[model samples]
Target: MDHNNMITKFDESKYLISMAPVEKVLEAGYYLNLNDQSNVLDLCCGYGEMLKLWGEAYGINGKGVDICDEFIKKGNERLEQSNLNHKIDLVCQDVKEFKTDEQYDVACLIGEVIFGDVSGTIQALDPFLKEGGKIVIGEPYYKQKDVPQALIEFEGDLLTLEGLYDTFKRSGYYVSYMAGCTDNEWERYISWSARRDLEWLRSHPKDKGFDNKEKWIDTWYKMYFNYRRPYEGWALFILEKI
Candidate 1:
């Protein structure tokens, strides 16, 4: 596969423009009994967007951690720009290795799971939760089978909804509720992302080593963006530690 081209196209277009899903998810989480005294940890919190949204609306003290330095940096910058920097903390650290001196009332692992080495990933974050704490996980169910096709194609370890819930259960966590997003979420996501990505590619022509921008664009629209089974939509599993 043309990794460079693929990365360039996806990052430049899909990543740059997508925001509705995060907003919608935060809206959903906000109504779930969050409060001012709540100490929240946003696992895999890319750019702290969710943290900012929830923190501002709910008065929750939020801290975010992501494996990507760029994400951490951008998150900090956005928090500062919003004048909520005092309430938000950003950490650039690997999720599997980062340790916290404090526990949180609520924790989130939103849309950033990449599938490999997940057992360790689950174990690492499990300790950060306070007793009976809540954890909100976001995942896609783009296929009907036990495994999602996107996961297999990307060499990702696909965890079924039952499997993930089971992992939490064996760890003494139980599901509180599960919500299915609208199909519009997925459609809007692809549409926005594809547009943003094209702009990013224009500005970052040489960043990802893509020599043929046209071919990159073609592959993205043809295979990557156009792929994926129609499901309405992603699943949000709200789990509570026992």
Candidate 2:
């Protein structure tokens, strides 16, 4: 399996699971903060969709930064369409290396975390928060024996929601808001997921094949089941720094 091709095929699900439906995630963040007006920092913001949604729908504006140039370009175009080019700032650079002079009321990472080094991941956001500001992290939790060996070996470190919460606590942050998937509407927003998986399987033809692959998919789906899945997958935690 060509890793690059796998990424290309999986981009949609990556976007779907991690990026799509930013409007609802943004609303959740806003509701958690109890404000319609607040500065937002969308770190790891691929294409700035969240910023565009917030600006266009709720009249809020913020900054979005990502490591990918294509994402930044698309994000700029989206902002332009929303006529929010001036309201939102888009940066095409490693967010960890980027610095903002402005302090934000809220910060969000509505995609995958626990990739790369776990402690380093949390520490990277240290400079972005304003005093009393809250950080919202969208995490996928699950139950059963769903965690994949591939994810642990290839993707990055995997942590349960409880583990993540405890990590934040140890970092002097308190969990303030947690949102679990309840509407069964998550699937409605993710039609492209099958395409992504198929592409991955095609790119990575192997003897191990669909047996392991189906298990991989099932692992995530099992996460959706509240009882069988670990602490429930797709949870958003709002944390305030102590």
lDDT of 1 by residue, 1-242 (tens): 99996774444333322334554555656645777788889878877877776776787888888888987898798789878888889899977666769998777776555434434445656778888677777765434444445546743545556666667678676777776656565555655656656877778877765556656656555553445434213577677754
Q: How does each model score on lDDT?
A: 0.66, 0.64
lDDT of 2: 0.64
- Which segments of candidate 1 are over 4 A away from where they belong? 1-24, 114-119, 146-151, 155-157, 204-208, 212-217, 224-226, 231-233
Of the candidates shown, which would achieve the greatest lDDT relative to the real structure?
A: 1
lDDT of 2 at 135: 76
Query: Clashing pairs in model 1?
Result: 12-197, 13-193, 13-196, 13-197, 13-198, 14-193
Pairing residues by index, what is the TM-score of model 1? Answer: 0.75
Residue 226 error, candidate 1, Å: 5.4
Steric collisions counted per model? 6, 5
Model 2: per-residue lDDT, tens digit, 21-137? 444565664665534477888888887766666675566768888888978897797678768888788888876677868887777776555334434555666567677877767
